[model samples]
Target chain A: MIWDWAFAFEILPVLARAAIVSIEATLIGFALAASLGLVLAVVRIAVPWTGWTISVLVELIRSTPLLIQIFFLYFVFPKFGVVLDAFTAGVLAIGIHYAAYCSEVYRAGFDNIHRGQWEASIALNLSSWTTFRDIIIPQAIPPIVPALGNYLVALFKETPLLSAIAVMELMQTAKIIGSDTFRYTEPMTLVGLFFLAMSLVSAVLIRSLERLLNRRTMR
Target chain B: MGIRTLVTLLIVALGVIAALATQEAYSLFLPGLLQGAVLTIEIAILGSLLAIVMGVLAALARMYGPAPLRWLATVYVEIFRGTSALVQLFWLFFVLPQFGVTLNAFLVAVLALGLNVGAYGSEVVRGAIQSVARGQWEACTALNMSRPQMLRRIILPQAFVAMIPPWGNLFIELLKSTALVSLITLSDLAFKAQQMNQNTFKTIPIFTLVLLMYLAMSLVVTIGMRLLERRASLGLARGKAA
Candidate 1:
């Protein structure tokens, strides 16, 4: 009974514009997490004494809420003289939170690579960097593509939380429209529809990427 | 000393120094944070109980119930799992008012979280049930057990052991999610941290104290879950074999 097609059509362009912010956060955030996670995974494996320290840090990041992490970076960090813009802080918190998960995925992939591969690289006189880049990382990456993709979808879904810090993402835009027009049914539903569409598309993309990765590995 | 131990000590030392320097801020804010922690725990406990119950029912409906019920369950899971929990809360808090069914903020938050987590938990439940070997299903059928009796007696016991670790992960996740309820204006831990920060303008100490409080709660949950998991897994092998 509350549905309004006119208002739905009216507010959609604004929502679409805001969806770009959400998409940007997801892409940049996922990039930071994926690269940082690879580094953490490698450091955890290569550096003996540092592994425990890295693990503890990762565990701390993993176990706490991302919102608190964002709040820390956005509100508290400036007090300690470490200032960042709200957008940057949101992306960083999401990146670091998911990096903990990604590192675990990479670690499992690292563990799965045959021990002989490391020994073979050593016998061939490859440097540690070469062994990691050429042997360990290549083998470690494919099995993890699916997991990384899942985090991508997850990160996309989590973008709305950035709205908490006033980032003007899709959800925030929808809320603003709803408050202004007092027509909640349209804008909020549109936001959910936008998210549903994005997730479904990502699910399809991940499935194909997984198939491609499996084929590449088989090859 | 190992680099790990040294680093940990250094981190701990920094925390001690910060606490000492901001002793007044620490004293004034700690009580507020603790009170907020109680509310956080309450939301988490109630939300998780709802989620687990909804999860069990949904998983059963999707995996074992008749066709129309399966479709209904699938739609429920998809709509919930596919969206953000924040938006779900907004829908309940904002949109539902348009339909003349306004829930109070606390109830709205709990419903949103419970439904969102329940969607994820249903997947866990479904996967756990399916992981109970196919042969077990056949064996139950051979024993002439009624469907309800078989599920209650045979399937659930085996499924429960497989369910524990993931449930633990979900439990921690659900607890952390209590932080989000603050968005709906619940006076929970995260909200309290922000409120104190706004009031005192001593953002660093208040949030630092808040972060540690959350981390300590998480550690407790992790430890409690491990204990529960250990107990649940006891004799699981023997049970599965029989």
Candidate 2:
């Protein structure tokens, strides 16, 4: 038997539990990315002097592989006295890495807003904070939601890389199962299916969220 | 650049050089890492070529082939695209032997990464082909060209230009993914770093060097893609000017 249904069923519970860790990592990492990315994009725009440094930092992060970045966080930072657990280090690396990409998406969104809108906010005597919070961000976010959602899915896929750091995510759990039982097919295939199902679900959710935003903005 | 930016860059350069100047560690680490980098580059290049071929065929079949081929292409793209690359590599490396088929680690690495990226590349190909303009297709038909001839002589040439930038992005992505091949026991860059770190406990220097090497390779991919894009577009510019 190339694939044993019984063995697959037996291992389903363990893989599913590990999947929660993967999902938590994705959600937390994405939250950090979403917020931190916005801040980075805003800082670049608002602080003209910081633009060069920020852009260079963004490009450096974007160009490198996430696996090494995670390793750097997990291993190197300890030498500098900033120790982080495997899970935290992995999530931070993924977050900061994706934040660079997400910032670009946000920048494009911000760019799409007409200059007159900023001029109008100034004319109305709105504080800069009010202008951004009540006006610019609301306008900027809708157009870029789908792009941000793509990153969400991308980040989810990246959680498997965290296993490289021994974070015990779904892929790591599956591999451990394989090593223990000496049966690779069922566990590996199940992990693949789990990723496919989750990504497909996220894609659908992103589409509906885009439509929802479009409707709200239209009204 | 501003003086501050220049200073910052200078400091970083000095730091990197100072770190690498540790003669004993440099001698120990560089050779193994470089050897691994060679294998990494080999996998990346071969994988990219495979990805391009798979992408073009899948995109063409999905767009124009018979129903069966189209369905097969669709399935191939989705399966490859949806799963994480690690799972796919493991399936090929570990599970295939279960069914009495075994491939070398290097072969599995290239096949898995290539097919995975090929799935993403197919979408880029499909989009570029679609963007080639309706009139171009109509003109090809009006000239009584066969389907293959129409695509070969007309559609693909124009589409190739659009494809270059996205294909560059995918190629860089493929290069990064080659790092995952190390997990299957290939002595690629990431695997080499981990192996050395475990042995020497020189985590900072080793991982930093690995990160910089990857960044350097990706930059090469980025710059190469830009030059290709510029060259590809020059013919269109000439035709318009003429």
Candidate 3:
């Protein structure tokens, strides 16, 4: 396990290439989770019958492990003639799993809204959609942004699970490179470092967003 | 009529439908899947037991130990809490073997999950113990009770009762987190479902079964926890009512 600068340099480019895939998966997964979570939350809160059903669905999704979901989607779905590329399946599974959590954030945000706002909206005879858009959402979203951002960082760390399903994300690439070179140290260390760096950056970014959102909300 | 009841009924209907649709496929994999489910339960229960032990020890160490021990406990808590459990699982399963300290998948999964959950649980334990009134501690001391005796008879009992809700939540989390062990080839429910999917190529049916099983497991845990909470809170409930 001697540090070989030459070996490190040789593998750096490959590791860097794999990082792009990891980032893409993280971003796509985060986007899907955020939007889907919002929809699930809104539906759960806005429509009683649908809300209860979605609540159970979300809970089931949340209680089960993401690894199983990813494997199911990636390896099983194709048997049903619904084939997704590894990358697509990876992101979709991650997104769907995290969406359950994100929905809780949204639910909390909705709960935090003042009761009077709902009454005021009803007094004005505003439709549910209009009332939610103009009044509740604007008030609900800011406080939750930081929590949601934290989940994004969490989602980034989870990208490694994608490798289990053979998505060739950063960790997978490291495994590949390590096995190829008969040296696990360099690639695995680099992968760990990559995670450390990305998580640090995201933490800082989320903290700043929290401050900015707080300042705006205070006014 | 409110939408809540309607939605509940609909979701229940959907769950029943999903289970019924998957009945034939589920029967085929039922034996293997149930064995996996047993493994899942074992990991969940054993991991939770380990977590409770570690959590109480770490919490005690942090509260009563020397400054250096406190710092060590703090570092342990922060590192585990800050990172993803999946990474910790990977490190335990993959990296430890490099150090010639290899463990089977089941052991590694339990250790990793226990350590991770213990980190979180320690905070809850510490908080619950601290929330016990100052008067209670003072009264024990005034009665000439030794520190360990006081802790065992007074402080810990109350703290343990208070710790139930948080522990319940963490148990649910631990149950879910156990799924990661399948990555290392533990034949837990997740792994079995994946195997069935690979063998039968019946994706929807297999996964539908997995989802329902998980839901049922979690529902049972949740219900049991609620009953425990109710039993523990009986005195408080009477006081409040009076």
What interface RMSD do all candidates show, one decimal each?
Answer: 1.1, 1.1, 2.5
Tell me the spans in candidate 3 whose CA falls farther than 4 Å from its real position: A1-13, A76-80, A196-219, B1-24, B130-155, B238-242
DockQ per candidate: 0.79, 0.77, 0.45
> Least lDDT summed over 10 consecutive residues: which range in candidate 1 chain A?
A74-83
Model 3 docking tier (incorrect/acceptable/medium/high): acceptable
Task: Estimate every model's Cα lDDT from 0 to 1.
Answer: 0.86, 0.89, 0.83
Q: Is candidate 1 or candidate 2 better by DockQ?
A: 1
Query: Candidate 2: interface RMSD in Å?
Result: 1.1
lDDT of 1 by residue, B179-200 (tens): 9889888999999998887787
| lDDT tens readout by residue for model 2, A1-219 | 788999999999999999999999999999999999999999888788999889889877877788888887898888889989999999999999999999999999999999999999999999888988999998899889999999999899889998898999899999899999899899989999998988788878999998998898889
> Which residue window of length 10 is worst by lDDT in model 3 chain B?
B1-10
lDDT of 1 at A10: 84
Top candidate when judged by DockQ against the true structure: 1
Q: What is the lDDT of candidate 3?
A: 0.83
Pairwise lDDT winner, candidates 1 and 3: 1
**TM-score of each candidate structure, all chains considered together:** 0.94, 0.94, 0.86
